[model samples]
Target chain A: MAKKQLPYVIGCDGGGTGCRVVLADAQGQVLARASGGPANATSDFALTITSLSAALAEAAAQTGLSPQALRASVAHFGLAGVVSPAVAAQVAAALPFDHITVTSDREVAVTGALGGADGVLLAIGTGTIVAAQRAGQRRDAGGWGLQLSDQASGGWLGRALLEQVLLCHDGLHPHSDLTRATLADFGAPLDMVLFAAQAQPADYARFAPQVIAAAQAGDAVGRGLMQRGAAYLDLALKAVGFMPDEVLCLTGGIGPHYAAYLAAPAQAAITAARGSGLDGALWLALATARGLRGGAA
Target chain B: MAKKQLPYVIGCDGGGTGCRVVLADAQGQVLARASGGPANATSDFALTITSLSAALAEAAAQTGLSPQALRASVAHFGLAGVVSPAVAAQVAAALPFDHITVTSDREVAVTGALGGADGVLLAIGTGTIVAAQRAGQRRDAGGWGLQLSDQASGGWLGRALLEQVLLCHDGLHPHSDLTRATLADFGAPLDMVLFAAQAQPADYARFAPQVIAAAQAGDAVGRGLMQRGAAYLDLALKAVGFMPDEVLCLTGGIGPHYAAYLAAPAQAAITAARGSGLDGALWLALATARGLRGGAA
Candidate 1:
């Protein structure tokens, strides 16, 4: 009798805030899933490796497989902070699978969004990054990290909210209902808001929703920030070679909610990705197991 | 006979990028001046304090006065990052003057422009901040630092340049003479440009002039950035209880350069400060030496 073929593949999307893992078969059917925290290899290399390992183990456990069994399988990880060779090697070493591949989260996101075809992908999560693909060539825009770039990400939005609050506090911007709501959410005498802003980029980014709420509620400054955010994203997408009619896949939380801000042309180009990082990872795993190949054209 | 009173007073404006000390007597006489680097008390406390001390000492030295003799008189400092009591105390201690007063660079600028009257002041330098004063009550806007805020600043303009370059690189934004000029200035191979942006906020900010040049050259995106920078500054100014007929004082390097962006009301409010940070500082010191007389109120 012929030996039974392994029926599952695994994928992981590791980010600054968390790591998500998905187990799927060759047909793109989800077999299991798991999550863990703070796995951005660039920011916290050891933690990222540990978290990726744990998340993969958890997903395998859910699928009724041992770590060794999972190690024999193929896997792919779309990870944040995989921009350098060292980071990629560290992350690859952390995964359980033998046939493992790593790429910038943005690249995998573009691939997942376009299904390995040519297109533009705008990812605006805690940070913002845009990737464009044309005839197998890839281009990137923004995602310069929180300090000097990532203009339209959740981090950017959150920073905008805090800035508005500071403006209101200092009497440089109007105090709107949204500002009050945001202050209340942050629990402030205003100094607390400053502390939050000074603490971390991610801290401010967490309040991006409140800013969106304020914009939704008709605060002009808030609205302006949202409009600019959308414009910045459009600019980023355009940077990656988007044109009048190309499909632009909107990924990340802000991408879907803020879709209305894109121009008709950009909106027409916008579509949701069928799969996320997990799916991309799973696809990589199955491809590896089947000896699927990409050629240098 | 009463000792001949010195007809002019000296004013020192200390900031993050540079320091300027202006000698103007009681009659607004401009006598002598000099400039140097990074004197923002909050961002670079020691350096700024040292620079301030040195600039003042140097100015006095040029006039044949010993540092201690200059210390016998009063001086005031309108400085960046002097917002906190500790910073204020630190700056106060560093100065050689018998009486020295410290206040936010914003307050002194407004006072200098408005002659201690109620008005709004928009200051845009490496960072942007607005301050408004009415009936002795003061409020602030923007100026959260380079990473998260400073909308209409030199820094903002510079970042816009980088954004444009990235856009061009990715084919999102169009390339123009401005883009070519900026890339050339930065010696761009794309990665070199990226490396420069990654190096420091100031490095990016230095390119702001390119955007200004582009605006001058009729690049829509470049023009839009300048206009938007002005608009953001206007929004902050407007938030400060602006009245249609009220005066608005525009100060700082970018502030004066982008004066065209201010709305009519904001423009009407716009006036050049008679004294800069140094004058403001002198005023504060004089007021303190005079025992908090009627001037501040």
Candidate 2:
């Protein structure tokens, strides 16, 4: 008689930028991985499902398993824009898996950053996500977006820089090299105003590099903005209950840039991430598989 | 043989809320006045034109002048959302008048507040407009809008209050009565985030009264917000060249509320507006008529 085939598991990490999936055996050894287009659940639910399906299919193919066969596997996903339980349920229902779990991308990022250990994850890009995980319990602060929160985010930095330029134009604040360079980008102050009138967070975030560069060069306005951002980050770290001994992993496009500005204690606590978000999803999938077996027994 | 009719002039003050037109004689004596619907030029140019024309026609009718005869009048308008000369030109082209000058509503407000004399106008509502007029040379600071500026305006206060609530929610800040009350209005923190995602400046400004009341009741968060707003206002005043001796007229929905917050010197310098924006428009209309006669000679 043929030997019984081992059960499979799937892990998915989805974000605004792209969707990623990995396939593994019951023992949790990686079998295959694949990537697809953007999969922000809130922005485009149907597109997220599509992207996830395509990436999962590719990973299944890599493991020499049919899509139908893969549907019987355990799975877990950490996705951007899963703002509520209803969204998480919708995402879970859309995917074909015998057992699955869905959660906000922040959770998986923290898990991946700390490798399932108790620590903090500060993921700052066009947005900010400050999260802490202890003994599998997790909590997050900030990452509310550019409109209300995301205080120390790249988007916040860029928008604050533009605001400084306008203040200089109004003579309320003295101009620095950063502010002057920012003003030069516009035909006039009104042009900048018009641009800001319709600018989205990402559009504003495009200016973040200039701010970072100016701050590194000791531009007063840029340094002020960075200091402000750092202050907010410090608050967030404390709010999340970051302990001195716990790992502090700074990840994402703009996260590590803040190292120079972080408090000495936080800097001392920093550690390199062991895995990506995909690894966190895989870790969760394995846990789900174990739970299913335990229940069966 | 027939006595020459005194040249007619039309003064129109168009704002986001409504349009007001005053039919006047060459000497700036108001004959008839009428009001119409909203006339924010940038938001709806065609609608603004319609509103202005309707108000002007009503005023002309009250003054016993035919619409055609009224079209020959010298007109001056201070309209909301006239951000550029091109917008002003477009507004002027759409109106039926022989001689007309179109400018930002700020200019007319400053003129009316000080009765065309040298002074400062602090107009704070959903937006903030700080303008100084010295010997007819006028300068302004702030009033860019809620996104880029409007630091001390109602919209800013309300938005800042919401931000404080979120900060409290994240455990990054202590919640005072104001923040707690604001949070209670939402189903949950997520609901507040959803609301902010789609909120306009007016929606945020609706919360200003709560902040003001809480501040009056000695809420720490509210008091801090008010103090921050007052500081920005002081900076704006300095930016616009507001002199200690100059008459500082507080106008608009939220302007006088800051009297308690302003510096003693600024409070001492405060004066009631001499006339409304319509009066300032009428003054400009008279100036236009005089210029027309002088050019003809």
Candidate 3:
């Protein structure tokens, strides 16, 4: 005897910071949304599994569905650090769902920004990644990772701000509120050096918001950091082949804020995402389920 | 009585990288010169003892004397990261020498650069620091640490080179031998990200020589990094109250190479170091010896 399969679909957008999930019915009607801890399968498989499970349970709980019933449903995942196909397959296979699909977080971001249409996206946060899609052909630039690229991201911006504080302390640059705050926070340059000696990109990213706040308050150093970040973002967009006619979307934690500082033309072309990344994941999950049911998406 | 105190003087210049020692006769004539591994007394007391022991043994061996003979001599210890008086006393007590005088590595560098006279020094290396001695009043600028200052240091220049490499990879800057080498060394930006996630300042400083070499070969990126480093050095010098006709001695592992890039007047004022930091430590040791003997120096 065949047990009844639930008509549930789940979409996940995961990264080093955390994960977001959306649950929907077979008809693509959104039913619930939830959040979870970070999920980077490549870095820690067990942690990613635990986080995804909690997120899934939360989503399932919203709809009064048991975990067993949800396991029979279809699922789609968009995650960071899924750079290799092997890892992608491994992550997909690790999931509890009967049917599964997995792709890069950038794909979900682009899909979310353009609402399944053709366009480009400049997403900024703890990191930056540029993605473009034209007529079903997609290309990505930047997001080479925080060290070699993602120059305009929150992590990069924070590092630059700290450097500015150091430069100011050295008298290579003038002091500002931003630099003062940084010095106060670190107590001294040695403290900052100690912090940098061990700080990860996520740790550095914590300072980005303070830099932005100081910039908005008219601190010269802070404004300079933002301007520099904007310029890098522009360069990244051009490098990724952003076109004039295509609708461009700036998405992510710091994306909308950064858009305000972009060049006038780029500013004019900027548009908000049509749907969230979780929404895009939900759409993909629905499309996958339709394929399984032998129906048009 | 007093072990007929050996008529000897030992001068030590110790830092995080390596240690230099000089053994001299009662007349202050050098009898030997030797080097040893890094000796940071406060952090690793045992390792410091071992390194200083080997260095002293080598110095004594050059004079055909035993280590026990050298132990009765007056010793001057100028070391890096020896910031507190308590630590200084502890290090002095730990050494085998009967009379011990401990100072900072910077003190030796300044005294060495100035030859015990009144002048200013611009020292550049893995880090940058400027010291000025005028009428017995000394002032220091820069070298707050790599995080807060050290604007034009080898570490700073290396970081600039890496950023330039990333910029080139993003097409925001042009390609050059420097960028190509960087990419080849790291395998890609992703690899670089992983490296940065764990790299220390010394790790970054390792690339500075390569950058300088490429610059000497007329690579634009290389030239730019040197020029920027020089400008920062200039700022550091000015901040420390460098004066005209002050016999501005540029000293350190990479100092002289940077002098060629300084402004004309500043370059003209530059002079060769009268002696090495080891010589300064020796001079101080001689003073200590005279004081112990109840004689005027």
Candidate 4:
């Protein structure tokens, strides 16, 4: 005889770039997926809520379940900029989930990357997310925003590139191909000075691709930056209790690019992520639903 | 025979710290001097104007001349944050000088350091000013601001120190006494993250003395930072056409501290500044008056 269907669950992964939502069953069976606009709670809470709601509604429609009906079951949201319990509480109040869990995007990313197992996560993009998970507990270092931390990130690479260009302009350092081209792109050092004054982290991250490509092609400055970034990553992984034999998932727009620069041990430990942050949210949602039903979570 | 006394001239040196005004004869003889509150135009334009006006009035009073009488004389202002022609124009329009020359503080600092002779100036403080003065013209490389440039400055040293502490916390590098003490000061790395988020260049500069002292004591991190800073200074000095035999005036609260870290040739070139920024302003004002009199300028 066929088994009875389980209650529907919802999971949402929100960030500055965009949002992803998943529809699934309490047993962790995926039903449908949906994408939405940017959902960074810290950047635009109202817009983030709208994006999440629309995406949840879309995923629910794909599974032929009303969002309200899914909300009655269980839901989990892993969102960027949810740095504190107060922020998570605010997000929970905004969403229409009856039984919902809200957490930082890093936690979900690590969960998805490691498939809920113990390992390390290096999510380096415009910002750096260095975290480790052990027995379902998560710990992180760095990612303290660009002004203080976020070292070895795309933003860090781009900012360092600009600084090098100015140094070359001053005749303190000779202009490598990377520095020369970068300075040329901005017209002059003064123009770069103007850009740096107002450029945000994302704005600086725009140069990461160039730096990555240059590093691959043996540009001294580019390779130097990648090496520096790799060194920081090595330190961060060790700080997070990353054993060389354990899975080390290097994920993000810029993370994979550093694979070539990683130490031999980290290179050996590198592994592809099992799933995405949305998947991790769905796993969490499934666990929440099972717990509420008095079943093994 | 004793030369006839020339008309009075005025010179003002205004910075974030405070403003100084000197009243002197066109022949460069000092008449009187006065001081006023902070006059950083970018920080508070109205207050800068007030500071300048009050200092000018006070100096005129000491010389037994009406403020209005001094306004008829030649005056030169070397001011911080006078980056553009528009800013200088605004300053000129606000002050009551019949003939006024407005320029960047860096220019006057170089003049004061070099005493109107061609040489290099290394002015490192919360900011870094690297300039080469030649035949009445000045060319500068850094001093773009703390955001992009200002390498080897007290601000840069302090910021790097904080970055090192974070790196150590992440297990990326070993901590020295400097980093350990620095981390202890904040109680925890998170506290430092909090402090750095709102720290200005000056705020970071507060840690420079500790780093300086630690380097003196042979603390590994402190020495590393000083060495790195000295490397940048070497490049800047070379870029500015600094020669082993040429005069190199290292001036500023943090400038002389770097003497021990400088290269052998740079150490050999070091010379005490002939005067101060205030004296440079006076020299420029006298020059302006002499030009007006159709005499040697």
Candidate 5:
């Protein structure tokens, strides 16, 4: 039997904190977007499916589509904690969509940031990673996940700021605005026990905004933490063989905040991402639907 | 009901990692010493009691004391993660003892470091805190636990080393012996995720020895981390009103390693702790048994 081209597609960005689903027509025009609860496939596969289903329902509702129609749409999932191929297959099998592709959030992050073009996308939110596309060949330098590395990410910055606060806790270095503010935020040194005792990557990342704010306020320690994080990002770009003059997109929550601290040459190379990870996922799904795998726009 | 001196006393130092019990006489003479499993009271009060009991039994076995005899002995516990009086009371009440007193691990840390004399102790192991004894008045500056603050501790140093390794992951900073050693230990960045994802304070602290060893070998990054930690220790000491020529004992696992990094004046003031936390517990137990509270030797 011959198949008719699906009229729409769905792009999913599933993370530990929450999930985002985007619905678009075959022409890559957005139809609807929605959000749902967490979908960390590694820790809870059932929850991932449930979250995806909920998010899909919301998107379909927004687009005035029926459940069966939406189910027929091609879908692409860029999820956190989806590191292994086996897990990806399991997720794909569990998903209700007729045609679907699942990959690391990093992949869609790069695709979305670069809009299927050959360039680099450095995602530095709760976690960190650098992904680049050149002549349709893509490679990643970091983002092994939060356990191993996420160098210049928000979580990394929060962790680094915490270390700085503890380092200054001794007054071995002069107390700076950063330390004072951090201590004030977390309260007494003793109060920090509960925070660190139960802190996840997102918990640590929660302090990134504060660190950024402090840096902007001329806090020496804050600036140091910011610059250090940026340096790591810079290193990640270089590690992936990022050449000057090539387009580079700094993606994620804290990615853009680091621009000012990057080297002049690299800074000059930086540019806005052509689209969001949703756009990238949609493009991936559309391309895959046509049997054009890893074919960049 | 005239007061009678107890025949024996038990001094306990219980932390997240392990429990130490020392059995002593009313005269503060050490009789038996033993170790047992972890006993973080805040995490699991029942487990704490079990571990403490196990440690106490070992100490009793060493002295050939029966269970009933040991239960008759007054027990003074210095336990980690017992931040509130309520928790302490709960722990004390759960113990199978005729009489019991519960205080923080920091208290015995100071007592052990100062040997009951008026002085200050900076404990930097898996956590950080400073306790000062002056004019029979005891004051503390830190040791809030790993969450709140533990500046210059093994955990802090380990965390710093991890940051350095991540930073040097980009080779932004030159590869030093410290980074080399850390990478070799963790294998690759990918392996670090499992470590960070599952790491407790002790897990991060495990790298402290490697960092120290690297520093001794003249690794620039290692020395930087060590020196930074020492500075915090100095700050902690100063924060607690450390006076020149006053006996300041540096305690804990990484306590001694930071000595060289301390400033000249502070280093000059640093002295060897007269006893261990067990000894301090014994001293405190004896003092309390005699109705002398917080009184220096």
Candidate 6:
């Protein structure tokens, strides 16, 4: 009797800070998982490709599969900086798979959360971006960047906290416990604020947890920033035509926390995605594999 | 021969908004300014007051002199809100003065411009408010209001025109020539925007010019709301101490325009005799009476 072919797929999710890869079978069981360094394809394509490759190799090693064997398998990538067609092609070229597909990290997250339904997905982690999928079309709202936009992201919160500290140092605002703690973390003279803000968005986002803690401890400045941040997200939701009963998915680290602050309309619209970028990638991989079978036949 | 006491001193300058008044002498000055709807206080307060107030008493009419004569007369007032405690009080209480003295309207202008000399000022009109002056003290930088805070000012050009319109439209942010023209005129959907944003600080500010123009165009939405209308002035300049520049001054509108914006700031900051409220009021009236000072005391 002929041996039966195993049904498995490979998936990758890449971001500015890191890349994650997962190997899974048809039963939705993860066989192997691996992580690596930054993989934002737009800003640093070579480094992103290298990290993605290493992560895939690490996952394959766990499965005891050679590079050649993995190359013949189906795979999908959910990657940052893949908004442009040229960038998407570059990401696709980096991955080794018989059938591979690439899409924006935002698109993958939306697909994973809503099962490819029509709704808005507010992905706010280290950075913030709002993407709306309606009637098979997509539109982007905020997420200009750390400097000009991204009004409700972790980075924005950090920047606002730093601004409050600087304002206090300049005697332009009242000094508060949160400002004191923030100044202590960064050291005296307070001129370092300009330097701190010069870092990339993800670097700034890492400081958001401290701000959240400060807010919870009754820091009016911190609390105000959070409220403003949530309000910014609400504005984005309004831009996307968020219906009261629509299944709006909240993704990323800060999304869950910010979800609590959303109004009844937004709350009723809220639903957490069952799968993340990895799951979406895996789904794409399986779909690609099915397409390959039909094409070959 | 004994010198006759000039009991009344009147100072007036009118421009694109309304007329202003200052009644003072060498010893001290009192102020009374009235809004004539849309008369320019920077150019002709004399004519504007005719329409604003029921009747003008000639004794202190043109020179801000009181109907009753007093000794030693000096009247000066910069057209717009200049920094001065006396000026602020006069504007606030509508008090007529003898021996009235006013300084650069810019001084009281800062109170209204920065919302009360404790935050950044971004006054945008024909000019801007990028000035970084601290209250009652000299700093390394003071950009002269319109010349400096232009970054945040409506007169800053570039993105500001677009931002005003976009912010007005529920943050939908559509860019078009029609939108730009509508923003310049402060009409239509813009009227709705101004009404809806009456409570928000940024929104109130964004819609102020719209309200001003609507009143100019004889629209009902703009005419009847004076106190709330003035509150927009208070809100925009409210964050004076939010940064190192804790004092602001105005560069737009006419003399009485500054009065509306400065009323709250003067009440909050002027608790003593030697405050900017009085000083600015005296300075504005004096500046207007520069040529007519006769002889120094």
Candidate closest to the true structure, highest DockQ: 2
**lDDT string, candidate 3, B1-297, tens digits:** 344544689899886557899998877988899999766554355777688888888878778987676877888998765656776887888888877888777788887778668888887766665888988788877665554456777777877788777778766678998889888988877677557645545567788899888989999999999998888777777877776777898877778888779888789898889887888899889987887777632
lDDT (0 to 1) per candidate: 0.70, 0.85, 0.78, 0.82, 0.78, 0.56
Query: What DockQ do the predictions score, one after another?
Result: 0.25, 0.64, 0.36, 0.47, 0.34, 0.03
Q: Lowest lDDT 10-mer window, candidate 4 chain B?
A: B1-10
Identify the runs in model 2 with alpha carbons over 4 angstroms from their true place. Answer: A1-77, A89-102, A282-297, B1-40, B43-75, B92-100, B289-297
Model 5 chain B poorest ten-residue lDDT run: B288-297
- TM-score per model over all chains: 0.75, 0.85, 0.82, 0.85, 0.86, 0.56
RMSD of 4: 4.8
- Of the candidates numbered 1 and 6, which has the greater lDDT value? 1
Tell the DockQ for candidate 6: 0.03
lDDT of 6 at B220: 36
Q: A1-297, model 3: which lDDT tens digit per residue?
A: 675454788899987667999988888788899999877665556887788889888888889988776887788899876766787898888788778888878877778778768888887876676888888887777775564466778878878888787767766578997799789977977678667745656678889899888889888888888899898878877877776777889888878878778887788888778887777888888888888877622
Tens-digit lDDT track of model 4 for A75-143: 889887676788799999998877889997887788778986888899887778899888978878787
Lowest lDDT 10-residue stretch of candidate 1 chain A? A288-297
Total backbone clashes of model 6? Answer: 99
- Write one digit per residue (lDDT tens) for candidate 6, span B1-297: 677544334444322233444445544555444333322232233443353243234333555543444234444433443323543444423423444444334444444344334433333443323334555442321112221121222222223333334443545554344345655565554243334322212223444465455545654334433334344334434434323223334345321343443455433442211233324444544554454445534
What would the DockQ be for model 5?
Answer: 0.34
Model 5, range B1-297, lDDT digits (tens) per residue? 666535588889877667899888878888888999777787567878889888877787788988787777777899888888988889988888877889889888887887657987877777776778988788676565554466677877887787677657754456786787678877975466557666666778888898899889888898998888877667767777888879878877888888899988888988888888877788877777666422322
Query: How would you order the candidates by TM-score, starting with the best?
Result: 5, 2, 4, 3, 1, 6
lDDT of 6 by residue, A37-98 (tens): 87767656899888998898789889997677677777788887675677788778766666
A-chain TM-score, model 4: 0.85
Going through the candidates in the order shown, the clash numbers are: 18, 0, 0, 2, 13, 99
Alpha-carbon deviation at B51 in model 6, angstroms:
56
Q: Least lDDT summed over 10 consecutive residues: which range in candidate 5 chain A?
A: A288-297
TM-score of 4: 0.85
Candidate 4 lDDT by residue in tens digits, B91-198: 989999889999877867887888878888998767788888888777787777677778888878899999899878777789888899999999988678768766
| Model 4: per-residue Cα lDDT at residue A202 | 68
